[model samples]
Target: MTDGNPDRPVIVLVHGAWHRPSTWDATRAALAGLGYETRIATLPSAGTDPSPTASMYDDAEAIRREVDAVDGPVVVLAHSYGGIPTAQGLTGADNVTQLIFLSAYLLDDGESMYSRHGMDAPADTSGTFPLPENPGLALYHDVPEDVATQAVADLVEQSLLSFTGTVTRAAWHDIPSTYIVSEDDRSIPTALQEVMAAHATTTRRWAGGHSAFLAAPERFAALVDEIIRSR
Candidate 1:
């Protein structure tokens, strides 16, 4: 689309905690098939970086680098914990025209994953916490068996700082945004996602679990394509 030039806005995908860019393979492929240019922000708080101090702000800055580097319009599509960084990173980015939060957090200024989830304590007290041996039931119960197994095997440890870090600016406050709520999510309860979805300009729902992108890449890509074309 647009001859693969920077004229058309690109879809920058931000993945959730414990996940990396590889998690978006299927969705990215589908988007490419639809002629959408897509990019994935390297999450500092995720991957096998072995860095014990990556915070949410660091992740935000990583995304900001990608956002600021791009030309033309941008649709920052964030999933799960990714919503936090995208919300922070997109602040003051003139090129970003839209935001799409997929089963993700949309916190207010001074809010955090810990506070929003009502978890009195942070999961990464020791800097980073290893992902559970089995996240199938919590995050991938409804996902296809093979996909869920691969995703679980690929999960990385996430920084605890990201869990407790609070947002200084909520970009969604000034940006047009759509939130996709995962109705069957077990990691982030559907009820809570609905509450967060209220902060979005509009909302959509999917009868899937937390790992909706991996479980239903075609559907996710179709929705993203619609958003991009609407602009």
Candidate 2:
């Protein structure tokens, strides 16, 4: 597909499950310092929003709104569960020039976060899902203790339905894409990430955990900047 326009694209940030738009604060700040414009999607499955039963489709629609709102070219950067929705959201969105998947799931049409990962669709529990075993150690293994603790505390109840919803459109098929693989990710196995990343046009590997955006902010930001400039 064409680049659409010669102007620099706005960076659209999409956070994974259990996370709010605020989750991208550090990355946003770093990108801002580089004079890059950015926007984060407010996901319905993120828990704080009213809809507790929101599905991945809802998340995709939410992200689509943000992408369509931008006046110029757009580049989507999706993290973790954010990948599914962001990919669906960009369906036929010509303004979106490229997609950057960061330790993110890349599913095919008719596949889902649950099926692809072999996760049982979570039950309809009254409260949020339990934090992963040693969440801090798993998600932010390389991050500072305080930072990891704070990040965990900030997580909200992600809707279980989100994982079950199947992807209707795999936008990567039509758009240029890049995948960033986390070598030490404890949440999603590095091998699985590599399998899904095969769908991307290109891939890069880095040493970090699932939350590399936080643990390796400068390096992550630099990579993002490099991707943008190279485009």
Count of clashes, each model: 0, 0
lDDT of 2 at 205: 85
* Candidate 2 lDDT trough over 10 residues, lowest sum: 1-10
For 49-160, candidate 2 gives per-residue lDDT tens digits of: 5647777889999999999998888899999999999888788999999999999999999888777967766666333445577777778888878888899888887777
* Residue 106, model 2: Cα distance from true site in angstroms: 0.3
**Candidates' lDDT values, in order?**
0.84, 0.84
Q: Give the distance in Å from residue 189's predicted Cα in candidate 2 to where it truly belongs.
A: 0.4
How close is every model to the real structure, measured as TM-score? Answer: 0.92, 0.91
Estimate the lDDT of model 2: 0.84
| lDDT measured at residue 92 in model 2 versus the true structure, 0 to 100 | 98
Instruction: Show the colliding residue pairs in model 1.
Output: none
